[model samples]
Target: MFSCSTMMHIPTSQFLKLSKFKPIPDPRCKTKVATLSMGCFWGPDSLFGSIKGIMRTKVGYTGGSEPDLPTYKSIGDYIESIELYYDPSKITYLDLLQVFWNNHDSTDKSSYRQYISAIHFHDKEQEQQARDSMKKMEETKSNSIQTLLMPYKTFYDAENYHQKYILRKYKIFLESLCLNDDEIKNTYAACVLNGYLGGHISETEKVRILDIGLSDEQLRYLEACL
Candidate 1:
């Protein structure tokens, strides 16, 4: 004969699992900031905005002398540009360093779309940390490390309308509130190519240039599939 024991059920807050996403003091989030330049600011802004503990995110030009200027045309674009704010408590600045590696193609051009990776940190330790991570990424990742580590310049907050672009453009975020994390990441990956951008990608292939970048490979793959 087996005896059954009563198990006490503890009411746990959903916050336990998503603890990394806990709301931090963004207003006083004095963590050192960093800037990046990948491509059209809309996608980068949208992707990073969803990340928790990001005090703020801004889009603009960098790696040039005109810190006060706003230049969008890639025709003669000289500045590599983007801006991001993070809370060090939840995510370290180094975590962002790795993020920069995965998100863009550094082989395009020095100042071209997702060509160079640059880090703008405030102090010696932070710079060292970013530099170390950059080196490590170079050794580990298939692509060349084009991320330039430098002092941060002025940050030009994108136009007021551009803020929260994913929320504004996709018309899905409002309802995403009803979903969970895995659901949300999947939704994003699925809906990423919706409409014109959809139906292009073929099945995964064995021949992918891990070093170059995904967008170009993606376009080629889709074309072959079609």
Candidate 2:
């Protein structure tokens, strides 16, 4: 049995073995990117990590001044944001916007810029789709959505601790992958693990990872997650 903390959906164990694991190939062709700021970055990062089309997810600072290397404490005018690389063939940008709006309280009245909600569009098409979605949402509801539709800007990655907040809790699981901090950021395996931590891993996704050359032990661990 997993501990109370890790019993969210998967069993947990401290045992780790470094076996020969195949690198998850990046199968995306002409991927599109999306950026969003909806309260804390951790949840959004994990949330998107679970989606089918997501190739990579990163939490960072954006939409503010003082781009001089933002630390959590020194994030001058920046708000928390998530940068996502996704395949449009598998999931549409509009599909992501739906998930974004559903995950956040767009009507949030918080005065803190860090907690404010916004979507950074990569191009006019995304901007238009966002606006259309916002309008459609308002058509049936009374509360005004406060999510800002802004143009794309710079994204400064947050500290390592904040990158995969949920999955990082299981140090052994990460150690099994033998990935350095930088490697985890770019790895699709990390993305899948992060998503699994967030209860967003689908059965199809689970099966895919099982074939990624994980050891029997690691495969069992992931199986328990499913």
Candidate 3:
């Protein structure tokens, strides 16, 4: 039996209907990728995923020196990081950089490499932008920003359990969507739902997503969960 602490009943048909719902991509939109490390990756995953322009968000390990694979328990020199895809037409890279700097305590130094705040820039332009942003931040605070600006090497996807960490708490909601682990990690719907469940989604984004073909039952369940 499907049960939750919220004790909301969802019909089987709702699940079936939601299973068919897919996000329609804009043909004209060119997506840009951003990789950021800010403490634990889970919170950043939810935070960035909630934004309207973000197409997908994935938590992973990057900028590590170790050759071995990095798991949560076995991370070598890797840092807990989040990589997200966003439509540049809707949101600029500078906007995401601002969000990254604003949300995390970049000033705090961490002894552990895995928890250090850093930006893994994909290109020269991004590297310059990150450096300029860091300079601005340092100027505003009148202190050196401890956040590292580095060239992005590779992103190793974290274990299945790490994806959509917050939204996974609600079993009924996940069941209704009928998505497997990979789908949950990649789908825009799951990303948005994860954001909403984590209380990161703004009202404007809420209204925008609500009008995106969600059934009445799904809408009610999402609202109730929030």
Give the worst 10-residue stretch by lDDT in candidate 3: 1-10
| Candidate No. with top TM-score | 2
List ranges where model 2 is wrong by over 4 Å: 1-12, 16-20
Q: How accurate is candidate 3 locally (lDDT)?
A: 0.80
- Model 2, 83-173: lDDT tens digits are 9999988999999989987877787765777767888988899999999999988776678877788888888998998887777876677
What is residue 66's positional error in candidate 3, in angstroms?
Answer: 0.8
Between prediction 2 and prediction 3, the one with superior TM-score is 2
| lDDT pick, better of 1 and 2 | 2
Which candidate do you rate higher for TM-score, 1 or 2?
2
Could you tell me which residue pairs clash in candidate 2?
none
Error of 3 at 79 (Å): 0.6
Better of 2 and 3 by lDDT: 3
Q: Which stretches of model 1 miss by more than 4 angstroms?
A: 1-31, 74-80, 110-115, 170-226
Once all C-alphas are superposed, what RMSD does model 1 give against the true structure? 17.8
> Which residue pairs in model 1 clash with each other?
117-147, 117-148, 193-198
1 against 3, candidate with superior lDDT: 3
Predicted structure 1, TM vs. truth:
0.55
